[model samples]
Target: MSSLLEITWTDPVTSRKGYVVIDTLVRGLASGGLRLRDGCTLDEVRGLAQGMTRKESLVYDPADRYLPLGGGKGGIDIDPGDPEAPEVLRRFLAAVRPIVKEQWNTGEDFGLRQETLDKVAADLGLASTVEAVFAILPDADAARQRLAEAFAVNVDGLCLADLVGGYGVAQACLVTAERMGLDHERVTAVVQGFGSIGGAVARYLAAAGVRVIAVADRDGLIRNDAGLDVELLLGARDGLGVIDRAVLRPGDRTGPREAWLDVPCDLLVPAAMSYVITEADTSRITARVVVEGANMPTLPEAEAALVTRGIPVVPDFLANVMTNAWWWWIVFGDIEPTAASSYSKIDSTMRRLVEAVSVEADRTGRTLRACALQLARRNAEAVTERAGVTG
Candidate 1:
């Protein structure tokens, strides 16, 4: 029951392609991240936009109600290494100028960053920053300012990318573990991917006394039964999330970068790229719980196998609800995000969401992913009903 609209524009002069895929527009507005990657395609944009719809609308209901925002995604297909990248982006932006004001809004994603997008957004003659391109309209800007006012900060101070998804993943792991009756203070976990989201989650989990027994980055996988020193590994990690093999100690175990799948622990977090887990990985997935920290990390066959084996595959849609929750709260309520309180808010909300879904899953004897999909589907129904759009 996913919905979408695909818009593609190609600059004749630059030969660069731009895309806007709106999964469904609630109240005539759609929003999501804008990604930049080489070889980007329309199908990929549609998939991401659909994920965005699920992420924003799913409220763990029949657990709770929520404000439904339709999902949209933007993609610019061009290599960043090209010397004419800026010019190419300008041309692409111009191609979509009309719709950028009316139909869709976007923020940075994948190869893009909010700071860089904000700095360069002016060239596109757009009021929205690349971080939050769709929020340029007066209503959206006023809403952001209200969020700022709640936090007693300036309008320009808010940045959703700081810790939203990463923090939620860690919090959900802890809460999910507890819901399974693993009430101990120190739960062990193995994480794949060592970059921004992965690193942030690992750091937070380690600090919270979760034994991060193994870590995988682009360079290789490192394991320690007694738990790796997250701080030390963080220091050794490169920009690409690659940890140097030389940083390993004498007794530590090392394997291929993808060997993280074989590590035994109470929790497994796939925080890297999509579809890392396939049918082949099911045999090696020893962890009791698989918390998806990335979009579509587990393939269909692998997911079914895990669920059939009594393993809980927490879907990305439910695990990464912090950002959407934050946005919903600020716009619907008075709470504004602040440096000091944002972490606490994300932690509490994530714990609540994970617990709710876990409870429902336990009661219904269903996989966590199934429970999430149920909630997302129901929420989509609510949106369609309220918006008076015939399904």
Candidate 2:
């Protein structure tokens, strides 16, 4: 059965409606983020909440069992780019702060940042303001530190791998190459997003000797078989993650956005928005491996088609959960973070997760998705039992 969920809120200050979706809760606690986007829907928030709960349970050692931590997600349907959007968000939080303090812990997500979270906490006059802000804000410094600590214990000294989801994608590509008995050094990669996450992955792959041949962002796509300069391209990128078109020669660009998928490469990393790889574009993907850096970048049908073509995909939730886990531990446990500690934790968790899924899939002759789901379910069950919850 699907989990029971709830949504409620109202912003008297901005008159915006805020929706919080709680998928499950254990011991009166649930964790998730507040996403502000132009068209975020309640249904979308619900799905995200469920994903968080599963991810949290999986990474925190389900065998220790605890009632579900209850996953909750909140969002406001407004473009955060607007000048007054922050005020709108503040009002929204003010309306929901009472409920949030009691049960639903919210954090930063899409279009939300640490500064915004801090502002909201200050508006409410909370003590240990930074700590309180971190409690409900995703990826806050405190959250990151906690994650670093957990990851440090998990992997011991390999901090480079856990920087972000993009690093995870790079690791996945490495794992895929090793499994296929291909030369990792010769592999070429195409990244669909040039944001921090995507850029990090590209840089990591380049540093590791893989050729990153193509990169595309909201502005347009740039291709160079000779390999584009990661540092140069990053210099041209704006705060919104769009690459500046003026930096590239006209001939180096392509049109119609979707042309990015047609570029030939050994690996494709979709680090942009969700559902970018649809059924129509699935057949055009020439990459040997598709590692998602964003949540649900490929629809179920597209994933199935790719699998049918014998292409291996690392599931988004599995590949990207390390970041979520890191933040959760940071805020919940009050840990201090260092760059070395954070990177090591991300690297170890990603490596073990990719290797485990690969081994399970090979042993059972099942898809990576199937193996991942089975593992997630098993972990969830163990955690539930440890929490002494049965139904």
Candidate 3:
């Protein structure tokens, strides 16, 4: 389906490009994130926006008070580390302020951080990054407070907000392991991109008794045959998810990022950038299962190759649905702001969603992504019908 709306904005000072794509809208509101990266493009944002549409639809629950919003995404082509990047983002947001105030509800994604986005948005006099959806809420102030409380939550020093998505990713891996008849305790995993998602996934998987043997970051790959200390590594990470090599222990070893594919593990998680795994790269995957922690980490041909090799993949949209769902759930009062409430909701919902896709894949003999997209489209149709919407 074609996007409902698309906009391109160029920063006057930096001549940097930015984009916004509203893939679809159930009501008046659309939800997604704004990302800042050196080479972001209209097409990438468009694809991500469409993914957001399926992501929103995938989490639809008739019994819950939260109705999923439509999908939208924003991207700017400026390196996050650039000295003038802040001003570039400010101008881009200003250029899109009208749409942001009314239709586009966004937070942070990829190269952008929530605190930075919130600070910029606040300086622009926007009530919040998600101010667009306030009008639809029964109690906007209450919802804001609830979400704030939720964001402030932590378990073992990790913020609940940062961990929810990774929790969902970990759940997918655990379930897939079970389906493949692998012992969770004996499972070994390698994770790429030690950012928020990858770090949290490693933490949760390690806590679940899965030995995380290798982790890759911007600096390179860190490996430990006996499993690196995930908690220590997490604490050593900076804002950009780069681990401090000073924290390395006796058993830990470091190598180039390419070595990530060489680590013998039962699960491989690409949690960093999009299109990191090409068709040829699939040949290097030794994992029995691949769980996407990042959006569009695997190319079409790579995914097909993995499928041909009898590897099961937990598609990104389904695997990473919890963070988006969790936000709306809190905003719409379907869930409390507590970590317990968030974890419980995400865990149960992810399990059911993953199981549904798995069952459908078995019945139809389709890849998990194909089956998941089928379920999402069906739900999107149901949501549209219930909303009395027609395109």
**Per-prediction count of colliding residue pairs?**
2, 18, 0
Off by over 4 Å in 3: none
lDDT of 1 by residue, 1-391 (tens): 5455678888687777888888877767666777676777887788878888888667423233234567888888876556776676667667766666666656556555555565566666665532233343346666656554543542223234545667788888888888877753568899998766787778778878888999898677899989888878877776456787777787688889888998889999998766789988898888889998877789889999998887879898887666556555555443445544566667766776677677888899988877777877777887677657521
lDDT of 3 by residue, 1-391 (tens): 7999999998888799999999988778899999888898899999999999999999888999888889999999988989999999999998899999999999889988888999989999997999888987778999999989988998888788888888889988888888788998999999998888899899999999999999999999999989889999999999999999999998999999888987879999999888899998888888999999998888888998999999878899999888889899988898889988888898889889988999989888999999999999999888888878632
lDDT tens digits, residues 1-391, model 2?
Answer: 3656566565565566668776777555676767777767777777777777766655655322112365667888777787878888877777767657766766556666644676677778643222433444545564555544543542223232234556666777777777878786788988888765677778778878888888888767788887877767777777566777777754365555667798889888887666789988988998898888776789889999999998888887777675566554355543235555555666666777778889999999999878987887787777676766532
Assess the local accuracy of residue 342 in candidate 3 as a C-alpha lDDT between 0 and 100.
87
Query: In order, what is each prediction's RMSD in angstroms?
Result: 4.2, 5.1, 1.1
**Of 1 and 3, which scores higher on TM-score?**
3
Error of 3 at 160 (Å): 1.2
- Mark the 10 consecutive residues where model 1 has the least summed lDDT: 151-160
lDDT of each: 0.72, 0.69, 0.90
lDDT of model 1, residue 190 = 93
lDDT of 1: 0.72
Write down the lDDT that model 3 would get.
0.90
| Residue-level error in angstroms, candidate 3, position 217 | 0.3
Q: Which parts of model 1 have CA positions greater than 4 angstroms off?
A: 9-18, 37-39, 60-66, 76-91, 130-142, 146-160, 236-239, 244-254, 331-334, 384-391
List candidate 2 stretches off by more than 4 Å: 8-17, 62-68, 126-163, 249-254, 331-336, 389-391
